[model samples]
Target: MLKRLALSAALLAAVAGFARAEDVTDKLKTSAAEVLARPAADYVESRVEIKRGDATIVGTLTLPKGAEKPPVVLLLHGFTGSRDELPIEGTKEGVFSRTAHILAARGLASLRIDFTGSGESSGKWEDMTPQGEIVDALAAFDWLKTQTNIDPAKIHVLGWSLGGLVAAHVAAERPVVTATLWAPASNALYNFSHFLGSEAVEKAIASADPDAVIEIKLPWGATTKLKARFFQSLVTVDPVAAISHYSGPLLVIVGTKDTVVTPQPFAGESFLAYHDGPEGLMVLPTDHAFDAFTGPQTVDLMAAASLAFIEGK
Candidate 1:
């Protein structure tokens, strides 16, 4: 009789667990439907100004309608990219902007900011560094915590390319609950060598003038310049080492064809370093930007994947 009672109790517990799971799924579906039923413009949008030392970082904060104290995601852009990311000329939506809107529709709020020297923010591009950007990100986090409509404990950070590196460092040092990296450049020195070539990098490192500019010509014929200090500072930061400090939930999304960051060595290294927490990796057939070779569908796929991870689904 005791054995039969124990079996019955086990069966009851299983049924209760199943019912709870179904209830959560049903709520998610309802939230998604409500988000989809409304247009992007229907969401409440606000301009945010965060003070970082002498400079003011500018950003946009978007919230889903009727969401009370919703979880928020902080979006960070890549090198030479702004808060809007590199918007595809005809459309105003870049990866960050599109992702923010989609997340908002799904009952999530997002804040995408232009790092101190990038976009409309007040600073010189030549003066921006990885450390400085990390400071700006932390400041943004502090600002977000002050918002009455945002849940401070549920803040998530997502970054692409250089921004991804920044996001990792911020997650390690801050109280971030989760972090997502999209084609994060794992090695700063390697990237400098890849873009500027070994000879140029060597010259920049040996140069006595910290302010000396190294002009690198792009494949498209335009030339961009970086200060000597930028390369010098990069040599001090190991992205994998920085990321290892964070034991929270991590999600890494990379492209198989991403010649920019390269998936082989660093991608594997990044996935293995987060040994203390839950980690996920997704590889797409797209390029570094995830939309360079594919259509707009790539953005949708990225948003869906990211939302799934953030929502714990």
Candidate 2:
């Protein structure tokens, strides 16, 4: 009889523990959903198209309501990522989109563009290169300069992943007041070597034809062709060195669990390169795509941190 009673008590405790754990999980999900469900009532979103050389770049500009000559943040997405980072369509809850809305809510304007080959932009994926992205970003910045509603002196640039490197390169040449790099690819050579084996990269580099294409099988089982010039371009440009030239305030945001752009050499080195600028580093407890791998709360945290940095708080 006593053994039966003890077994019943143990089972009850286990069930209660599971129930408690479930309750905690439910709360977290609810909180994260709430953050993503916020409305963008205080901002006006406009679809924009800018001509960059032969390609027509498409994007969105979010301008805050009742703010005259407000500062604008130019957002650049990562490699293979569009102006919207999330895979879901017609949702403004993605990292870049959400950040833009959040910034608008805070009375700041923001512009997010699709690079030539990605999003709604026009170009072949195989033709996209880091150098090309820099050119596209500069074109967007130049276009922003012509906008009468924007404060030219307070223009800022924010880049994520590969886009982070492009943003740094643009800031180096352009007159950006501030720059925020999230999970930036500090070394393109290192990234290429990791994605495409060193042997493949070496062969591409040694090839006589600059237009030679190499077939690369990604981790997600998709095979894509890239030009030999892509690898060559990676070797020529150093993102950290380029970023060092920008005298504006810099904010580096990296995820602690980011294996895509390893925190050690990439994030640490990129953070170290901004020696001349007033720089700040934020290490979040998440992965490379903070919200994608973790949850919406990670994005909420990121948005909060970015807003604080932009507002100089």
Candidate 3:
């Protein structure tokens, strides 16, 4: 039954054209491929298990070419992203994966994993929660600590979109990570409301009832009970509050033209209020995904700033 619902959701996402998150990932992949035709240092790509009590979260770990302890950075994808879904740029890597490769090339080990129920992990997305994802991250951190070539004190967390919220929560809970957020949502309530409302409005701006937005039913009819719970739980979460409690190195990046997660109107003050140190926030002259691949320049900036912050440079 769960598998059926998941499949139906995928079909609906495809038909409804509601999956804007990955709308441009394919383009980014094509662009990245052209940028990554050359060879860099050797790296290992594998799956690691993170145990959260009864459930095991499967994750992808990418290791740099080295035989000694290396600074480790954990990369997290946005909502609805998979471990392999992130592009490694056959020629030009996408932002998330590009950062991972850059870290590996600079002698840092990186790991980007799937959420508990998404990607290749063995769970149902309907049963997952942001808090559950946080536990998965902790499990990953513990696993990384056991690696022979990973330095525990030099660990960092980099999250994009929804992953940024989870990253902030994990950093708050652990308090030992150097954290970076790319186009992260701060106030969960406002964020979700704006997301649903904006998408609905974009589709209904010409409708007779302008206020009547977000009128879509669920994949299996009305909103599933589980989805209701998910939204309810998410509505109460506050990533900005979580980050405010974290006292480690932090960074935030946002595109100036981002309509999906624009920080200016929705979360600008929250971003400013929470980052309490020598943090970095770069506003790129692009859209939500940084569709403008002017030489992978935006991602390159994020990588450089993150490395500097993690190494206290």
Task: List, residue by residue over 112-206, the lDDT tens digit for candidate 3.
Answer: 88888887777877666677677777777777777776777677888888888888887887745688777886655445545554343234334
CA lDDT scores, all candidates in order: 0.75, 0.76, 0.63
TM-score of each: 0.84, 0.82, 0.73
Single out the weakest 10-residue window by summed lDDT for candidate 1. 17-26
> For residues 1-313, what per-residue lDDT tens digits would candidate 1 score against the true structure?
3543453355345334321111123333344344445555446888889987789999999999888999999999888889978664345687788888888877889999999889999898887788888888999999998889999889999999889889988888888888888888777776656655656776778889989877766645788777888878888876677788888878777777777775333453454354357776666667777774345566666776777777776
lDDT of candidate 2 over 1-313, digit per residue (tens):
3543453355344334321111122333444354445554588999999997778999999999888999999999998789977742334377888888777887789999999988899998778899999999999999999999889778899999899999999889999888888888877876666555666777787878888888887656888888888878888877888876887778777777777775332344444454475666666667777756445666666665666666665
Alpha-carbon lDDT of model 1:
0.75
- Which residue runs of candidate 3 sit more than 4 Å off their true CA positions? 1-40, 84-94, 198-226, 265-269, 292-295
Best by TM-score: 1
| Order of quality (lDDT) | 2, 1, 3
